[model samples]
Target: MMKPLPLDKVYRFIEPGPVVLVTTAQGKERPNVMAMSYHMVVDDGDPPLIACMLGPWDYSYRAFRATGECVIAVPTVDLAAKVVAIGNCSGADTDKFETFGLTPLPAKMVKAPLIGECLANFECRIKDDRPVENYNMFILEVVAAWVDPERKERRVIHHRGNGTFVVDGRVLDIRKKMTKWPTYIRD
Candidate 1:
């Protein structure tokens, strides 16, 4: 039995990855953050590349454009509600860090601060901006990364393209099934 799916709802099926908080700052201005779900890993090797979408509509975009750097912080399911609320509001008027009670730790390689509450934070620099004119996309290279090892809840939240969200569940390790890529398998 086949069913029809609305074109607008296709995003729910092709959801990129976990919802992340992007932090940016310029000169002496207060750092700003925005919740983002429209990002993908373009390269996974050393100093990985990530493609993220941001436009003028996003207040942080201006900072990103000015500084050419930002922090991509990965939040767990515990911060799902705050993450959604962050995306709903604009950083122009609201100090997201104060409004959301998120701690901003200094980053090693970039001016953008790292989020202390997130599972992981990737400090990145703009590598390619050719797609920014038409696609509002920027390719970023991770300059440094940080992670909280003490956090127990590691499950990530995924947006369903609406008000609804999906949380990560149990893990199913099938390393034995991956014969060709044994190098990727870990014990």
Candidate 2:
């Protein structure tokens, strides 16, 4: 039998992708890292774009406005607690990188530095801001991407709200019908 529950708080079902650390920087000011899951790939073409929603109150909001750039760092199961810590604290009052013991590496196309610990990083620039003024949404274009070659097993975490998390486990590859893997814009 099937069940129909209340739809008032249904974000956990619609969230796309695993939890990611969104890094934002502006000029000489201290950079910030935020644990976010409200993001997804809006355009998968050559110059891929991402749709993200951030509260106007977040420090990264101002950083993105000032720098027009940000980076999405994909974390694994190892950084679960740290991700919660990063989300619990406010970057406006503390240096997240120093607090979390994360290393920042220079990015190729944006001022926002990449997280050295993440398995993958997406460097992006603001492509559209219409959602920001209306609904606090942002559409960013991925300019550059980096990945760690050493991490053979990528076990990322996904937030399910209310102190619950789900880890990515097992892979079911059914590529029999697919011709080939898609190529990135850079390729």
Candidate 3:
């Protein structure tokens, strides 16, 4: 086998899963929105937490860190092209919400705005920023979350390699046996 893989490569392999829009605000001015893929649900109870990574150069980074608030918007497969467009451009140079024709809705608990077109939006406040400068990691405590009732039953879209996307389809469940098996197992 090849020698142990690099740590950076291992971390990247598990990334680019969800297609999310990271929204941030500076005071009452227009909120900036940028497409992001490095995010995950870290906890469930008592103000659910989410972890997201942002490049130090990203324009939304400072705003989010300053206000300690943001909204994670989950887009659908139909918005895949727009997501790619936003990801390709810098929010510092362009108003992505205007360019993409995405409407902004006021969030209940956070200063950031939510994408109206997204299927779900999570209003979150930064819980920790220690890892931001170190690993581009930011921990957010979800203050409020909402999902479009019409799209509640529909599958959400996820980012794949290149510009491709995969829809969340078909739920599968498998129960693990109480006894342990030494050999490897495949599903």
Candidate 4:
């Protein structure tokens, strides 16, 4: 059997990905927002699927579970400080949207609102919740998506270690022929 890895050392081993704002609304009340890095896009066509992990103790976790809806907002490098701030605080105690100066945009299919300042936003509905209670994981189906045209071509911000972050860097295009396996060598 494979040995189990310790949780304390797991975060670093996982690939560092972009930080996102998870917006959730329980019932008809105002939505709550939190910053998270444990998420990824699953598909690009039609209704996209997004997978994210949330701690059971997080306020947004319960809100998402209760409402079965959320919005994932991709922030830029300029918003790193604000992202850290929101991640450090609890939505249950403070009005994060107002404090962070985040504009809430109405979503077409979900109660949760999108963050206007973000470069990209994904409105999603919970497709399954069993994983959340069992492993703090959520799978969502994107109902809608938006992006700022100006920043669409620019690099987005991503979270690194120790309160540090890296912005989107230069792009490198590789020809498919150059990506062949070693055994498939060509002259």
- Pick by TM-score: which candidate is best? 1
Q: How many pairs of residues collide in each model?
A: 0, 0, 0, 0
lDDT, candidate 1, 1-187, per-residue tens? 9799988889899888799999999998899999999899999889899999988899998999999999999999989999988998988899999999999999999999999999999999999999999999999999999888899999998888887888898789888899998867854
TM-score of each: 0.96, 0.91, 0.82, 0.82
Which portions of model 1 show Cα errors greater than 4 Å? Answer: none
What local lDDT score does residue 129 receive in model 3, on the 0 to 100 scale? 82
Question: Tens digits of per-residue lDDT for model 3 on 1-187?
Answer: 7798877567545655677888999986678988888788788567888888888678888788788889998888778788888888877888888989999998999888989999899998889888877799988898899989887545666765456677788876443552364232333
Q: Report the poorest 10 consecutive residues by lDDT, candidate 1.
A: 178-187
RMSD of each: 1.2, 2.7, 5.3, 5.6
lDDT for each residue of candidate 2 in 26-127, tens digit (9 for 90 to 100): 889988999888888888876999999888788788888888899999999999999999988898899999999999999999999899999999999999
Q: Model 4 — which ten-residue stretch has the worst lDDT?
A: 178-187
Which rank order by TM-score, best down to worst?
1, 2, 4, 3
For model 4, how does the per-residue alpha-carbon lDDT over 1-187 read when each residue is reduced to its tens digit? 8899877867755645788889988876667899888887766557778778888778888888777888888888778889999999988888999999999998887888988889888888887667776778878888888988877445566776467777788776554566656443433
Sorted on lDDT, best first, the list reads 1, 2, 3, 4
Most accurate candidate by lDDT: 1
Worst 10 residues of 3 by lDDT: 178-187
lDDT of 4 at 170: 78
lDDT (C-alpha, whole model) for all candidates: 0.93, 0.88, 0.81, 0.81
The residue-level lDDT of candidate 3 at 181 comes to 44
Clashes counted in candidate 4 amount to 0
